[model samples]
Target chain A: MGGDVIDFYFDFASPYAYLAAGRVDGLSQRVGRPVRWRPILLGAVFKISGGQPNLNKPLQGDYLRLDVPRCARLWEIPLHQPLPSPFPSLAASRAFYWLDQVGGEHSPAALARAVFQAHWAEGRDMALPENVLDVAASLGLERDAVEAGIAQSQVKDRLRAETEAAIARGVFGAPFFFIGHEPFWGADRMDQMEDWLQRGGW
Target chain B: MGGDVIDFYFDFASPYAYLAAGRVDGLSQRVGRPVRWRPILLGAVFKISGGQPNLNKPLQGDYLRLDVPRCARLWEIPLHQPLPSPFPSLAASRAFYWLDQVGGEHSPAALARAVFQAHWAEGRDMALPENVLDVAASLGLERDAVEAGIAQSQVKDRLRAETEAAIARGVFGAPFFFIGHEPFWGADRMDQMEDWLQRGGW
Candidate 1:
């Protein structure tokens, strides 16, 4: 809390979070502060905040069609559009929790990327155990570890706690940030994010 | 379009637009550009884009209650908060169209403030016909003229056409600006709005 660190609150299902994740590392280095990734569930945030599920909107399906490709092209990231929304995010959330627990050479960032790719790049459903395992293996993580983590109660509990923390702190959406208690909500605010954190969030 | 003029697409329903409406004069003067008011119905824009009805979102209502006061206090603007949800925007849009019709004094800025205040301060429903007339009367415009304009078929048609033009220009939401062929959305982008309009929108 003291030395210049920005806690980046993220949700895996968020395209904006996916966009910000790719940039946070470089931003952190340039701003001379480290970013701590706090994984939170977006669905819960939306429910409490009264935010609509984008997929449920009248143009739900088409939004990602325009937004995803446009952002991917801008950031030059590879994206695989899922045919059916890549399924429940529970497993992907568990895998990241397990990855976070073990404290291996794998950065949360690597696991995060792999999970995004599982749903977004490979167009694979996250609900499928095989899909989760495939993405885990691809990230050089052992499938056994992921399976054990998913089966454990701690994974679900951890995610619930994270979501609760986000709600308690007034984070109503994904890619929301608290640069020293000031909430900035939206992807377009990244430049302000950089400036905010760079100036120690004045 | 060929001059230093920039089209200001505004919605009486949007508080940010209200903020912009009042401040744009000074912003234009500082940035050395002329801003032309172009009012469009936000309801139509929301229909095509993936935005929810105001009553549908809890945080929106919450933000309206909590954030508006703070924003007005910070920005030193008169924000009347009792306005009905989605305050009768049709007439508000129509009124701006009327202002454009009469070729007004005060540069359409008063109409802009009335629109903002109708929704944010007086709690007037901008979508309501009565509220539009009331706002116009407050601005010293003849009540009959404002109401007569709203009844005009051509004015209504023009309003609809502007909304369609907004959609056609890739505008997905409220408070949009056009710097040449490029369109920027939201009051959040005001800084960027100034930057682009000045630099020929490079």
Candidate 2:
């Protein structure tokens, strides 16, 4: 994941993650750089940090609900919350790592976009294993193999190792990016990140 | 506080607050609008929200420590962490509201800048009452009156009420701004806020 690549870490269930997902690739293409899509489980990171998701908070929850749509409108992206939002993202993460092994390098990025759209743009449930396989199949990945891949021990271990590595690297939130050791947090920092990429950091 | 005025909320003890304090006025001037500088105590708001300062968090603390200086350099602002960082901001907040009463419309803004500079730029300990009085004296205010002003029950009550009002308005963090009730959180959202002001909100 080194050598002029943007290590983009995100969780499928995060609305802000989806927002960044929509832009990270285009930004990469514009800069003539490749983006390595690293999907991490925010729940496990939150457990270690003793923090809770914004959807569970009181005043923050309402403001975030409003802000997400505002951001979508401003960025000109389609966004709609799923029926059971704040849902488990493990199935989506497991599918991603499985694709990373069987499918080509670009497959994970394509599948990540579809999964994010399924949960964030189309308002489809991502917690179900069936929904995850449908997203992979649409990307032209085999259906039965993708289904079997989710339950494989190697896929589970890969996701676990990636999340732990993220925690060890001090990544406590979603949509976190590493531009060659300089960490940029939050979707709001996208402009700053682009400036850094173009200007070669300050 | 209404009618095309941007309500800018901040705490003197917050480094991120200092960053926004430096930019909000310039953005307002460029957009041909006014800003009401509302100094708030984040500790009180944290008490209600079950949140703590970033300095206490594990990963967040380290990332913030790096991000603050990076932001400062990028903005080309002079910044130096004061001795006894995270110093008490009561004296500064009380001085602000008192000046808001006795002084003219621009007096509070001038004093807020001085207090922020004293703590964040000049590396002075704002926790000391003397340091706060010195800041007020530099602004041509009566020193003895400013000294006594910090101890007044009414001044303390004003800061408390403003903080509670901020919480009621869904302000959960420092450097929060409102372009006529459209809430924007974080100093990074400064660009979006300016765009909203220029385009008359999306």
Candidate 3:
């Protein structure tokens, strides 16, 4: 729980999480803190947290259709809404954990951004194994090993375990962050989170 | 639909709305836009929007308990959690519409701030009619007339009608704002709201 480490939990399907992913790494580096990117299945977290996905709410769903693009434009990130919106993030989450096993300090982060960009930026179907593998290959990771690793029992178990662990630690949403056990939720909270770090928590 | 007007929809019981209420006036003045403060019941808006109050979710409730105080401190506002949390805001909303009937450019705005302070700052029981009347009286409005005005059938109906109007306009949460029909929801969107206003929306 050192001040040098920040824990970031996110899901591939969340637009806000995509937004946070783009900002967290740079902010962490600037603030001289290392980030642990813990990719989780928000669907599972929602179940434990008694929260329903925003996509399931008709009004919220419509609002997000407009909001996501607006936010992407505001943040200066290239985003295109996926054809099949709110697709399963399990495979992508699994890829992350699999990559974490062998990747160095920045490899997992690179893969994380690639996954977010593949789905949200390029509108690629990350739910598809081939698409995920294609993204992994684009990141210069071995394709056969990534394909095999995602399908591995331990990798899938690790993703599940991590999601449950996040729930146990009171993570109920995507783009949830923790700096020394102080929780900051949502992409909108990035500025406040930075301020908290600067002031050493008020 | 003039660029000079910003429509602000809020509920008295919402903590985020309280935060927004504190800042919207100054923002309006700075940006040279007029604010139309429309106080509405979030409960009524939620009924049609298929949404529930955030307090109903245990995890979110816990997060808000801490987040509210943190935000209050960050914004340098006086905030004490209301004695009875999630108190009925009907009387307060009705009072606003009643005040709107006779008040000037800043009357409704001032009353909105006073009501928010009475509940969130002084920890008053805003659910009680007497408390609402007390807040109105404190604003230099007549005591007996203010009490009678809040109870007027038209005042009650205006509050109800405004809430329905807000729903019709696609407002699903408190602290919802609009600049010429470009909708923004949540207090966290305040900065984005200002950006949209400044840039005339992207």
Candidate 4:
């Protein structure tokens, strides 16, 4: 458990997850733990958890529009206007697993950051496979391999299994983290997470 | 706008609101603003916002059970086990408005803190009117007048109106704060709210 990596569960469609992605590396370095970047489909997780997108909730939707940018500014992370709709994160998420399987230890994390930046920071349309491939290609991964990798049934199953496994572990939201068996949710919880690591639970 | 007091919107049933109640005073002092403690019915607000208690959601409910106590420990606030069910907060919420109407400037805020502590810290059942009155009486308010105050139609109307007005202001949850027109939600957001007040928005 001492050497255990922090499991970071995220959805590419989530802006909070995007924000968490930007800061998690620094958190990892400070805490002396590697992060296991696990990209899951929130739509799938929400289906079982009876949760929905905050963007579909009444007041919460409006708050997100204001808070996300404010948080980005405060954290010094670049962010553009949100997509007209949530980016269809299926391909991007699948691409992450594929990279994790074939690439080096850090490659998947690098790709995750790139994909999050493309959609959130640069306003690229990640719903398009071409754009997702483009982001992966920018990371120097072969575009054809990424396209093929995402289409694999095994890769699809891995994401499905991962999302279901996250639900089994009581994760219902993006930007969720696990330090050993303890769960921490949301980008806002980074401070608490830091404290948890520093004090080993207060 | 400079002279405007910060508006603190809350419900007694929420542990997060209980946590916020403890900290809001220091926040008010540090920001050089008074806080208008407005007790609200999150149940009514949820009806409009299509939100429900975090304790009613699946995985979220489980997370709250662990997180609340952990937060209480981290914040150095005492917390016993939560009530078997949520504390029915209507009568307590009404008591807050009634106290605000007739008590001294700090009395209602004092009552809010006591009620939160009684329920959350001491494991008292705030669902019972007798318990709420007892807590108020302990604060030097006449018990008979407190009982009469909570039972008054005008006080009932005030609570209803405040809850509706909070909904109108897009408050979907407990521990919502407004600095002028800018809104902040959740106990977790206190730091962000403080930053907003000190920097006057980033």
Task: Give a tens-digit lDDT track for model 2, residues A1-202.
Answer: 2359888989887888999999887789887788989999999989998877888898778778767877776777788853237678888899999989885644788899999988888888898989988988888888898889889999999999999998888788988988877898887777767767677665
DockQ of 1: 0.20
- What DockQ does each prediction reach against the true complex? 0.20, 0.57, 0.63, 0.64
**Mind giving the per-residue lDDT tens digits that candidate 1 earns over A75-163?**
56676754336246777777787778878798877877777766766666777877888888887888887788888898789888988
Tell me the whole-model lDDT of each prediction, alpha carbons only. Answer: 0.69, 0.84, 0.83, 0.85
Models ranked on DockQ: 4, 3, 2, 1
Identify the runs in model 3 with alpha carbons over 4 angstroms from their true place: A1-3, A81-84, A103-106, B1-3, B81-84, B103-106
C-alpha positional error of residue A165 in candidate 3 after TM-score superposition, expressed in Å? 0.4
List candidate 4 segments past 4 Å from native. A1-3, A82-85, A104-106, B1-3, B82-85, B104-106
Writing each residue's lDDT as its tens digit, candidate 4 over B46-120 gives: 888778899988678888987887776677777877533577898898888898888674478788899898888
Q: Who wins the DockQ comparison?
A: 4
**lDDT for A6 (candidate 3):** 85
Question: For residues B1-202, could you state the per-residue lDDT of candidate 3 as single tens digits?
Answer: 3466889999888888888888887788878888999999898888888677787778888888778777776767788854337779988888889889866644877888898988888889899989988888887888888789888999999998999999998898888998877888887787777776677676
The TM-score each candidate achieves on chain A is 0.86, 0.94, 0.93, 0.95
Worst 10 residues of 4 chain A by lDDT: A80-89
Q: CAPRI verdict on model 3?
A: medium
lDDT, candidate 3, A1-202, per-residue tens: 3467889999888888998998887789788888999998898988888777787787887877767777766777788744337678888888888888866644777888998888888888888989999998887788998888889999989999999999999999989998877888998788777877777775
